[model samples]
Target: MAVRNADISVRRGEVIAITGQSGSGKSSLLYCLAGVLPVARGEVRFDGRVLGALDDEELSALRRERFGFVFQYGELLPELTVEENTALPLRLAGQRKGEALATAGAVLSRLGLGELRQRRPSQVSGGQSQRVAVARALVHQPAVVFADEPTGSLDSANATAVLEEFLTLARSQGTAVVLVTHDADVAGRADTHYRMRDGMLAPFTRDAS
Candidate 1:
């Protein structure tokens, strides 16, 4: 799935949705923009720097220091406690264990998981685990969060809760969001929505709901 001529420009603190069927290249475009995948031809610029031109170490630093991510599954470590799992990014970025855990605890509290900090990922419900994932993603307050099918595994109510929390945090922190989903409701919640087809993206039109 190769994306060509993609000209997406996400504004600060904006919520942008990209919707498509499975294997429609939506995630590929995201990976390219995020610097996870190499841009074969065109340039991917972030904060006015060309991602393709950056060296490996610089790219790694950029991702570590400026970006956040959420996936379809919570992807929390099974052995680590919820707090530890949420703080893993900070820990990897050289934060002390005590301070990382403290920050993680505060973010968890904001996500309504203050009481479940000691539990492992397997010990929590799916919805709770996903909320924890959200906490982990935003704990570092990255410039942008790239969420791919973030609420796909949850039921409607839980999905709503997760999306609401994401929006609230993004609004308060002025972080941007790039959400990829096939669900209309999920896409509808974003300020701007586009449908991906054959490696191309076009504006999404709302139908009577």
Candidate 2:
């Protein structure tokens, strides 16, 4: 198979969906865009900067300062409470521990997770854990957020709830959201949808007739 290239320009406050079949390279594309994967033959850009131009240290800094991520599984630290887990990024960014914990509390409140702030990940439901994950992703107020199959493991109701929360929060906060998923219902909620096939991306359209 030939290597493929895809580019997307997302405005602040917009949500973009990336959809593709298995083996179509959606995950690889996301990694490249996020600067987590080295670009050997092509370039990825974000906010006018070429991702491939940054060294690993620079890229790590950029990722921490500008990007947030939500994965399919809620990767909360096993030993941390909800508040601590949500506050990790802020703490890493040098916020004072007290301030970071306070900020985390506020975000958790916004996500309806306030009551679970002291609970460990093992004590929460999957949906609650995912909401905590979302809080962690946004606590630093990143310019862009990338979610890879964020709701993939949830039941329909839980997935819908998570997607709705993500879209609402991102739009209200003017954060650009790029999500990769295989589900049409999830893709349908995006402002722009693209399908990855044969290593390239194309606009996704439905037959109106």
Question: Best-fitting candidate, measured by lDDT?
Answer: 1
Cα deviation of 37, candidate 2, in Å: 0.9
Note the Cα lDDT for every prediction shown. 0.91, 0.88
Q: Candidate 2 — which residues are off by over 4 angstroms?
A: 1-3, 207-209
The digit string of per-residue lDDT tens for model 1 on 85-197 reads 99988998999999999999999999899999999898899999999999998888899999989999999999999999988987688899999998998888999998887
In the order shown, the candidates' Cα RMSDs to the true structure are 1.7, 1.9
lDDT of 2 at 14: 85
Residue clash pairs of candidate 1: none
Each candidate structure's TM-score, on Cα atoms with residue i matched to residue i, is: 0.96, 0.95
The backbone clash count of each candidate, in order, is 0, 0
lDDT, candidate 2, 36-154, per-residue tens: 87767877888778888878888888999789999999899999999999999998888999999999999999989999999999999999999999999999989999999999989
